[model samples]
Structures are given as C-alpha cells and as structure tokens.
Target chain A: MIDVQHLTKRYGRVTAVDDVSFRVEKGEILGFLGPNGAGKTTTMRVLTGYMPPTEGRALVAGHDILEAPLEAKRRTGYLPETPPLYPEMTVRDYLMFVATINGLASAERRRRVETAMERTRVADMASRHCGKLSKGYRQRVGLAQAILHNPDVLILDEPTAGLDPKQIHETRDLIKSLGGDHTVILSTHILPEVAQTCSRVVIINKGRVVAIDTPENLTARLRGAETMFVQVDSAGADATPVIAAVPGVTGVTIAARRDEQASYEVASERGHDIRRQLAAAIVTQGWGLLELRPLRMSLEEIFLQLTTEENAGGAEVPRA
Target chain B: MRNVLAIARRELRSSFASPVAYVAVGLFALVFGYFFYATLVFFAERSLQATQFGMGGPMNVNQMMIRPLMLNVSVIVLFFLPMLTMRAFAEEKRSGTFELLLTRPLTDWQIVTGKFLGAMAMYSLMLLVSLVSILLLFLLGNPEWRQVATSYLGLLLMGGCFVALGLFFSSLTRSQLVAGVLTFSALLLLWVINWTADSAGPVMRAVVQALSITDHFDDFSRGVVDTRHLVYYLSFIGFGLFLTARAIDSERWKG
Candidate 1:
C-alpha cells in the first residue's frame, strides 16, 4: 500500500512534479500513463525512496519515505527507466549482489536469485556478462535484480521501453502475474499496455493527476458520441435511406469502401444499437450486410482529451 | 556487513576483469621496481653499513628505503588510486545503477562504505604487488627487516590516505575523467603545500607540514610508531568517508 499527499518535485526554476496526490491500494496494479516529461519517473523515484519529495510526503507500507527510508525502501523494488546494470558483472553476480543489499540471508539470497531469474526467464543467461546480453535480456536482467528480494511494492519506470514487440508482451505478462501478490506502480506512456495489464489507470499530465480509474470506466465516462461501423455490399444501393427508416437512426456518414462494399459510420442517440432493425431494412432493400458493430471510445482518445484539456486549462490560468 | 562484502567481492572481480587494474599494477611494478633496484645498487656501490635510509639525497640508508619504497609507492598509488576510485559512485550514477542501489534496503553509509572498502581492497592488492622489490632486498644481502617492515607500514598508511582522497573526489562528481583529474590535482597540491609554506615563514610551515600526508609518513619510515601520525592518517580516511556519505545523502534530495 502507498499514500502520496500533495507531492511536489522542483528542479531549480522548473517544477517536475506539481502537487500530485494519489493512493495505490494493497494488491492493486496501477498503471501510470503520461506523455514524455510528465514526471512519471520522478514520482516513481519518490515512491521507492530513491529521492525525497520537495513538498508533502509519501508513505510506503505505513512507513514514511523520508523519515523511515530504509523501512520504506525495504518494502519497495524499483526498476529505473534505464535498467541500472554494471556491465562487468554477470547476471547471477549482479542479482546476488542486489539480493544481499535487500537484506536476504545467505540461503535465502541464493533462493531469491534463482527464483527471480526463473520468473523473468533469465536463468539461462546467468553466466553471461550483463553488457554482452541483448537489450531484451538486459531489461529482463534488470527486472530480475529488482524483484530478487521479492519486496512488497514494485515501482517500474518504463519497464518495457526498449524491448521489441514480443519482448514487450512477455514483460507485460510478467508484470500482470506480479499483481495481487505485490502492489505495482507501472509508469509508462504506452496506452495499450495500461489497458491490458493494469486494474486501474492513473493519467498524469503536466505534473498533475488528470484522471484515475479503471480503463473501462474512464472510457465509459468519456463516452459522448455513439457510432456504429456498418459494411454493406451495396455501391449503388441507397443503404443510408434504408438505415434511416429504422428506429433511433439520426445520421449516417458514409466512409470509403475497402473492396467494393460501401462502409458507413452511423451515429445514433445514446443507448441505441438498431442493428436488428437496420438488418431488416437492409434485407428489405435487398442489399448485403457484411458487418455491423457498435464503436466505443478508445483509451487513446480519453488520454488525449484529458491531457489537452489540462494544457488548455493551464494556459487559461494566467488569463483568469 | 554482508552487503559490504558482496560489493567488495564484486568490485575486486571487476578490477581483475578490466585492463586498467592490470595496467596499473604493471606500471607500479615498473616504476617501483626500477626505484628499488636503483636504491639497492647505489647502497651496494657506496658500501654503506647503515640500517635505515635517511631523509633527502646524498643518500643515507633511511633515505634509500623511504624515498624508493615509501615515496615512490605513494606516487605510483597516486597514479592508480583515482582510476580505481573513479568508478565508485560516478560510474554508478552514469549507468543509472545508483537508483537501483537507493531503492534497496541499505542505508547511504552502507553503500558508501561498501564502495570505499571495495576500492581500498583493489588498491591494497596493487600495493601488495609492489612489495616484490622489498622482498627482493633479502636476496641481495642481509637488509634490516625491521626497517623494511616499517617502510611498508608507512607505504600502507600513505596509500590509505591517497585512496581516501580519491574516493572523496569520486563522490564529488559524476564524470570519471573529472574525478580523476581533480584527485590528481588535489594530491599534487598537498605534495607542494609544504614547499609553499616554507616561503611563508615558520608558523605556516608548521601548519602545512602537519597537514602534509608525506610528512606524516616520515615517522613510520624511520621505524618510529607515532600515535599522532597514526591518528592523522585515520582522521584523513574518516573525513573522506564522512564526506562521501554526505555526498550520497545530498544526491537523494537533489534528485
């Protein structure tokens, strides 16, 4: 469990994190979404006790990060933006060193290192030098080092940043498996990763928390226009007029066809999915209906809307 | 303590893995070996029966042992200590491993002391290799083993001081090159401070000589165990370790 209250981090004339506050419940996987330079790494560093907040306080597992740093840090494992790795050491050596630093006993240190290596699928690369490994392997090695001691909290900053698509998926699965056992705060700009891996999402923009909720809830809350994608095999046929004849149809915008079938994006009032009626209308018009599906707003759209609104609101502050 | 040992073992292995450490040892052997043999050949030529090398040239036995074994060892250590200590925190910061270290349960002092001892261990290893010429003195003839032992003790103390200064400079910045240069410059300044103080009169000379690391080495080099000199070397080491701990603490707030 973690609690951050009125947190702020300033660097000289610039403020990196500005009075941001959020809580992560026990066993919850919270995805931190933000654009570049949105203070995601700074906030993660503060939470893991790598750095102290300029203002306010952060508590990890009921211990203050500033006052009881060792206790707070004991419960947290952090993977920085770039995997902090010593090039000269082998994977096993590095993980063992980290395990010892985390205060594991001799036997437990070996067990933890083996367990972490197995979990991150880096067991085979144990004997290889870290610098000689591939980027994906290096990232996994970083993950192994962070989780070697099996801390209660894990703060991973851009965990899958440099990985290829396959490696990213593997990293996502690794992170997802960590949920419910260890509270995780995953900071990344990848939208789909939040949708796929996190139980709740926290969107930060310009050093502020813009929104925090389930991915589904955020999309649902931002839902405004209801549109349906309909593909019909009717080029010359008047499909729009036929669809308008159905119930709840307000307007239809025809989209470019892919093959020879005409596609249309139909807009209707809220709580309206007239697929059956529209099918009957298409049947009556003797036109072939290929596909019909209701479209929902995506996470990307919600993110853009939230961040843009915040930027605009920031500009309006001086005007007011 | 376990963390410190773990770091020490890893750092020691890393030193062997790199060419820099080996090169440092080789360079030390070359310079120190030459100076040691030169002292012995000169002593043999003069047929001096004295047991100790006296201070300064025109070569007393005390000067022979101290200048070659003690002074030259410090000079060799001066060249290599920075190279070892430069990687202490600066390399970690550049590579982002410092963040990983902080997120763990260890305190700032634990990390700093662990790294300090680690670097010191490597330096000691290099110093041990330079002992070869001292051992070779036994083969040439019956040399005063007591004088040899005391000279070694002096070399160890001086080496410790240099390692401490190097570690402090290493913590002051994140650039290894800058750390190396600053360490070299600081040690060089200390070496010349006594000379500068002599020009400024008796009071200044007394202060500067007391502060001079080599000046303290003279006690041990003469087979004399001065408690004040021992304390000075220790205080130098403690001060550097203390500042290193504070530097690490400051980084947390700055970050």
Candidate 2:
C-alpha cells in the first residue's frame, strides 16, 4: 500500500535521505532498521506527507504524497519520533481532538476514541492530563492517537524508544497484533524488535537501503558456514583433532573449559550436518559428550554484519 | 470548513487549559480598567471646569470617554496580542505537534485560519471585558450608542490585524519569546511610522501616514465609518493572514 521511488531529501549541504526506494504491500509490517542518523525517520516523514522529498515521489494508498497530500494523508496515520501530544489536554480530549481533525463523524469519534484508549490501555488515565503521565503512558497515548482513525497505513518512528523493557514488550505485541490489517512502517535502532514483530526487515545504512529481507533469510544468507558449540569431558585427551578429522568438519577452535570438560566451536561447510559423524568420532576417542548445540546467528549479529560490512566496503550503490 | 472549526476548537480549548489565556486576559482587563477609569476622570474634570466657567455644553461621553478608551485599548492590544499569538505555531513546532498538524488531511490555509480565529476568539473575550465598563457609561450617561459600536468595530478590526501579524511571526520561529518580541517590535514600528511623516516630503509623508495602523483607526473611533478605512483594515488583515499562509507553506519545503 506504500510505494517510494528514488526518494531523496537534502538539507542544504547535507543529504539526509539519499535516493532510496522501497515498497510495502498491504498488511505488511516492514521494520525500518538503521543506525542513528540513517535517514529512517526522514524516509518515514516523507511517506507520511509531513515533508516533501527533494526528489522522486511517494504514494500512499495509490495517492501521490506530494500532489494529492490531503488524500494521501487521509489514509495514513503518523506517530513521530517524539509523540505529538498537547501537555495541557487530557488523554480523552486529545484523542477526541485527533479523531475530529481526522474527519471522523461525531458519532464514530467517541467510539473510536474509546476503542483506541482501551486498546492502548490508557482508559484508566483518560481523564488525566498528558503532561502528568509517565513516559510509557505517553507513548501508549501516542499510539492511541495514531490508531484511533484506523487509517490504512501507519508510520511510526521509534515507537518504543524511551519505554522500559516491559513496556517495550507490550508495545511490540501491540504492533504485532496490528499487522494483517494496517500496513505498518516502524523505524528503530533496536534489532530484536524487528525480529520479534516485523514480517520483513529493511536495513539502511548511510542513507541507503543496504539490505532488505526477512530476519531469518538475512541470518541464513549471511552465515557462510554452520557452526556448533560442543562441550565434552576431554579426560586429558583433546577432542579437537578427533572432531576435525570428521568428513564434513571445516574447522574447530577451543572455546572455554569448566572442570574436566572443554568446549569447542566447530565449523562445517554450509548445508552440512556433521554432528552425527563428529559425535561418533568423539565416542571412539573415549571422550564423553556433554553438550552439543548449533549456533545460529542472532539478529544482532546479522544487523552488525550487514551495516558495518557495507560501511567497511564503502559501498554507496544507488538502488535501481 | 469542518476541519477548520475542529482545529480552532482544539486550539481554543488548549488555550484555556493553560495559564497563558487567563494571564493575558487578566492583564488586559487590569490595564483597560485602569485606562478607562483614568480617561473617565479626566473627562469629568474637564466638564466640571467648563461648567464653572459658564461655558458648559452638553457632555458627549462618546467623544470624551469612549473614543480615548478605544484608542488606549488598541495600544494595550499592541503589546498583548503577541502573547495571545506567540504560541500559535511556535509551541507546536517546539513540542513537535506541528508535524502532527501538517500530516493531517487539513490544508495549510485551514490551519492558519483556525489558529487566527482561535486567537481572535480570546481577544474578543478581552474586548468583552472592556464592554462591561462601556455598558456602565450607557446606563449612567447618555453616550451615543452608534459611536460606541463604531469604536468597538475599529478595535475588532485593529485587533484582527494585530493577531494576523503575530501569527505570521509565530510561524517563523520555534521560540515563543522571539516571536513575541519580533511581533511587538513590528507593531511598534508600524504604530510609530506616522511620526516620521513630518520629516519627509509631502508625497512620502502621505505614504508613511497611510501605513500607520492607528491613523486608519482614527476614523472609526470618531464615529465615521468610512469605507476607505474599512477597506484598509480588511486589506491589512488579508495581507497579514496571506503572509502567514505563505510562511506555513514554506515549512513543507524547508522540512
């Protein structure tokens, strides 16, 4: 439901968002991952019709963001980096105001506001002023406003930036529940959030979309070899030589030792299952196998590898 | 129009929710009451002097009291209008609500008009407070009601222009203090522009004098509702609001 084509935004001498392009299908939760100052917020801002891009165009629900801003804006709800709130207004009044401005009918406005408040769990604080609420409540109130109108597209920037761990978990669950109905584009520097909540991830670095894929696919593609951590009771007999002697074993390195047990990180060729052969070899050497587990790359590792590796190679390739 | 009203309603509600509206209106009433009392005393003293000299004619309260009070209120608004409008766009930008406002389906003109009307609504309340003092004159004295109404019209129009100008300045900055200071300076400059008329040549003098906001207001305060003066105030308001609309439009590009 969202299409961005070669969108570029420049602030005088500095280009905040370079020529970047991406598309998000209906009901897709696209995680916008980037380091600080990676233009994630800028891209979302352009798509929300908050600011026009310096070059190219963006479409929301089949309407041009620049040419038909009102139509585009009508179908999109945006929660900026900092929640856009009026400190003087109560949570109820603020949401009602948002509902009114969003052009909801009077009869529908009250129901929508109540539903939003209930969903975000701000119903108890509805009468309390926004300024008096804690950071987590404020964030929830912000989410309520964005989802009140039930727009077709939702663009959130750092939705869980200042929340505590529990709040973050609740927010991620809320966002996950919002999928399959509202097309979501959320930006964050948090890697696990993408893995847990988003269906697809777009990793941007230095104002460019360096990598875009599912979290699982990204980790799978980046892992050139399968790795496993194995701990054994060496009994004064080293197991590295025996494990490395297996047919598919690529390499092995001593990891750590506890009492008489030593851990070895074993590497094998991709798509190879060397655990059976390696276990047989260890048994033949009279070494007791204590623990054996495959080491899958975490989203953190995949993110770091993708972002830093691109920077190291100085690749600024413009997406076609 | 519905969107405009919604925005205006929200703005008005938020204004009253804070101390800014109360403080501004309270200060206005205090200053206006003091000026009204001072001007009434001076008119009474002058009338008494005329009676003692056996040259007393009928005392025209509209001419002696209402006219001067209206002018005084205009001057008071020159200082207080910025307080009403400085937060119009400045606070929104500071608190990041400007993004929320612009990202909505409402147009720039709707936002500008809504904010302008909201500020004007508060200003009207300030004027209404002064009306209580004016009503007392009608009850106790035989002031010409037509002239009193005309003076109020003049105040309203002048206040509209002031609000428009203030809103324009507010849109240009994120600092409310800077917006207020800049608006006050701009109004003061316009208020004193007529002072330079004497030093300039005849043609230049006319241009400078015409630009003075108070000069156009003088006709309405005198119970003379000339279309020319009405046109001038309307044009002034239009120009100010037009500039404010343009200022907001530029924000889209600058962002």
For model 1, the TM-score of its B chain against the native B chain is 0.90
* Whole-model lDDT values for every prediction: 0.81, 0.89
lDDT of 1 by residue, B67-182 (tens): 55576566566666778887777878888888887888888777877877777777767778877766776675555677767767777777778777887788778899998899
Worst 10 residues of 2 chain A by lDDT: A311-320
Off by over 4 Å in 1: A233-247, A257-261, A311-320, B48-60, B66-68
Question: How many clashes in each candidate?
Answer: 7, 0
Model 1 / residue B211 / CA error / Å: 2.8
TM-score of 2: 0.97
CAPRI band of model 2? high
List fnat per candidate, in order.
0.92, 0.90
Q: Extract clashing residue pairs from model 2.
A: none
Per-residue lDDT of model 1, residues A11-58, tens digit only: 877899999999999889999998999989899988988888999899
Error of 2 at B238 (Å): 1.6
Q: Please tell me which predicted candidate would have the highest TM-score against the true structure.
A: 2
Task: Give each model a TM-score.
Answer: 0.92, 0.97
Error of 2 at B83 (Å): 0.6
How far off is each candidate at the interface, as Cα RMSD in Å? Answer: 1.1, 0.8
